[model samples]
Target: MKQVLISLLLIIALHTTAQQKTENVIVITLDGFRWQEVFGGADSILINHDKFTEDKKGLQEKFWAATTDERRKKLLPFFWNTIAQQGQLYGNRWHNNFVNNANPYWFSYPGYNEIFTGIPDTAVNSNDKRWNKNENVLEFINKQKGFENKVVAFTSWDVFPWILHEERSKVYVNSAFERIGFQSPTFNLLNEMQMTAPRFLGDGVRPDLLTFYIAKEYLKTYKPRVLYIGFDETDDFAHGGKYDMYLHSAYMVDQLIADLWGWLQIDPHYKNKTTILITTDHGRGDAKKEQWTSHGAKIPDAGQIWMAVMGPDTEAKGELKTKGQLYQKQIASTIASFLGFTFKSAKTVAEPVSDMLSK
Candidate 1:
């Protein structure tokens, strides 16, 4: 009887260890994707009239398919239909509400710092500030047992190495400036992309396409447990006041996101055990008729942001109709919970929002 009891305990311990080993999490950020775009289309949330065209009825025939949904379906069919249908998204309608200016600056670096560090800063005034990211959630997880070697970050933004403090040998971050392994074909393709895509005004512009390419390469080579891919094309296009470019970039991001999700399904290492979280660092300025070329200032709705999570652990909250606000800080805790990690930070973890967790 004693031997049997000991055998049962050993089996339970081994199973728990295996469960922990198999689970993985991926977080992807669209630099300037408004919550409006995530829930609906680009028609209604145009901060700039220049960006808002009447659906280009003619282009609908040439560019889009028969219906608006079908047209968008072609560009980012996974985000609009597949993930939303299978997962949960927030901040479009009244149901899933989120705060504007979650970070004081309402801009990229500050917002991203907040999202990864799980805290808000009231003093950050510009993107120019040299980012000093300390104790990012991923960094914390990397220090723990079993997660030390299974983490990575890829970003179109050149500054992400600073934002996440990836310069530390402990973190594996491959950004615009990092050298991908030269031997791999993926690395070769990425190098070609960087050469073709010029740096805009020395600020460093990484199109979503390049970001996706790097992520795909990383996944193929090293299947890290926690992966972050930051896409900056939408923000770049928005800053340029190129509304068409902005929308086109948004569509492109959607398509890539879909592809990554699908790839996970076919890959033996990731199938059935992985989770994905998609969100934006922040939103665009809420100018109904402005030139569609600004953020960081206090526009009426510019501060708002949105997020979506789809995984085996996520509960299916279909088409939320009520209004509720989620803060960027909650992301750290939510992600920790999803991976079966006991969140120890009282400062970071609140009761996991019921809308996000599996029922």
Candidate 2:
């Protein structure tokens, strides 16, 4: 009788441990967005510097606040008001809670590879259009039971198809100005608009706003279980030395995310069953304010990054103030863990972030 009772209790505990509440996961990336802005909001020096801000008065009116908390809320209301209230935010250097890229090359390709592959291969050191051989967690999830044909990625950057190796992975990737193949009315309208949209960044990249709309429409149409949205305007504007535009893009992206989250809560398929994980590919330099426009192996501080997660499976710890270090490589596994899978690859993958998971 004693042995049977112990056996029954063990089975019940195992069953409970295997169960998860998150049935869907959405991963969002803001390319090269800095932790400084994410945590401290608009920099007093940069906001007013003649070299950086073309309309100091206007930017001040928009993002300026007396305190860091107020400034951050002004800049990213969704993050500060929603995620910070109901999620876990990491990588506030002010609080000594650090999140850094494991990859040595602190640029786009390597940073993204580290994020999705769970391994920061030294060879992935360029932003060129080269096919990635690493198996990313997205493809891994797509191959899982019930997730087949339910994983998709929409990116503002043209190189994401190569970064994700859509050819080999078979993950649906719609990037840059590529027209959506779907024939729905929404997709058709988006396709027509994209064809005529100004390529302000260049011919190779579409605006982040377009990318957000495309991804949002895809979600409404197909309801992919795993979705990735990569926004590129922040990085592009910063590189062009347009500080005002960079901040504006950041604020716009925050609003877009808030809109998506609000929609998710109302949809029966996604309500209370979806997890949203947000982070940046890499950080920009801060020691020299000018270096804020760039990120690479040369800039040591560019390796610093940040992450935020809110969902049924994540704890609502808000902004983490405790001192702890996390790596970008852990993101792939952390994403998979939400859906009750351990992401594995040919190379050893970093373990999931235990702190973010529910107890």
Candidate 3:
């Protein structure tokens, strides 16, 4: 009788451990968004600089405060107010909590490849439009029992199709100016606006707002188990030396995330069962101040990045201050762990960040 009771208790504990709260996962990326801005808010050197900021008084009034805490809240209200309260934020170097890219090249294609493939392939060194040979975690997740045909990506940059290898991976990718094929009033209006809208970033890239609305509508309609949203305005604006627009775009991205999270909480399929992971492809420079507009192998501190996670399965540790190191490559396995799977590939994949997972 004693042996039977112990066996029963052990079985129950195993069953409970197998059941994770995260049923759906959403991954978001902000291209070239620096950890400096993410942790410390608006930069004092760039905010009022005559070369970078156009409307110094207006920008300062909107994003500036005496304290870093207040300034970050003003710039990214949802991140500081919501994620900080409910999730974990990493990569504040001030506290020695660091997140960096495993890849040597601190650019878009290589950084993104490291993020999703979990392999910092030094061979993936260029931003040229070419199919990625590596197997991404998204494709692996799509092949899972319950996630088949339920993985999709919506991106503002056109290069994502090649980066994600949409053709080979069979993952549904709606990027750049591509029109939504869905037949509905909402999708129709979105298609029209996206097609006819002025191409501020050129013909290959659309505004992040359009990408958000389209992805949000798809989330409501198709209800993908795994969805990825890649916003590009921060990188583009910074490269153009438009600090005001960069700050505004970052603020808009935060608002969009808040809107999406609000909707997810009320929806029956996603409420309390969905996890959102947010990070950046790469970091920009800050040592010379002028180098903040560019990132690559030549730029110092470009490999530093940050990550935030919020979900039922993740503990509410808030902003992480303890000394630790995380890499962009770990994100692939981390996303898979949330969904109760371990990401694997022909290449050696990095291990997941165990600290982010619940005990």
Q: What is the clash count for each candidate, in the order shown?
A: 9, 0, 0
| Candidate 3 TM-score to native | 0.96
| lDDT by residue (tens digit), candidate 2, 1-359 | 99999999999967866666899999999999999999988988789888989999999999999999999999999999999999999999999999999999899999999999999899998989999999999999999999999999999999999999999999999999998999988899999999999998997788988999999999998999999999999999989888899899999999999999999999999999999999999999873558898889898699999999999878899999999999999999999988888899899999999888874
The local lDDT score (0 to 100) that residue 86 gets in candidate 3 is 96
Clashing pairs in 1: 47-287, 94-322, 94-323, 95-322, 95-323, 95-324, 97-324, 97-325, 100-303
lDDT, residue 260, model 2: 99
Which residue pairs come into collision in candidate 2?
none
| Better lDDT candidate (1, 2) | 2
Better of 2 and 3 by lDDT: 3
Q: What lDDT does each candidate get?
A: 0.70, 0.93, 0.94
- 254, model 3: CA deviation in Å? 0.2
Model 1 local distance difference test score: 0.70
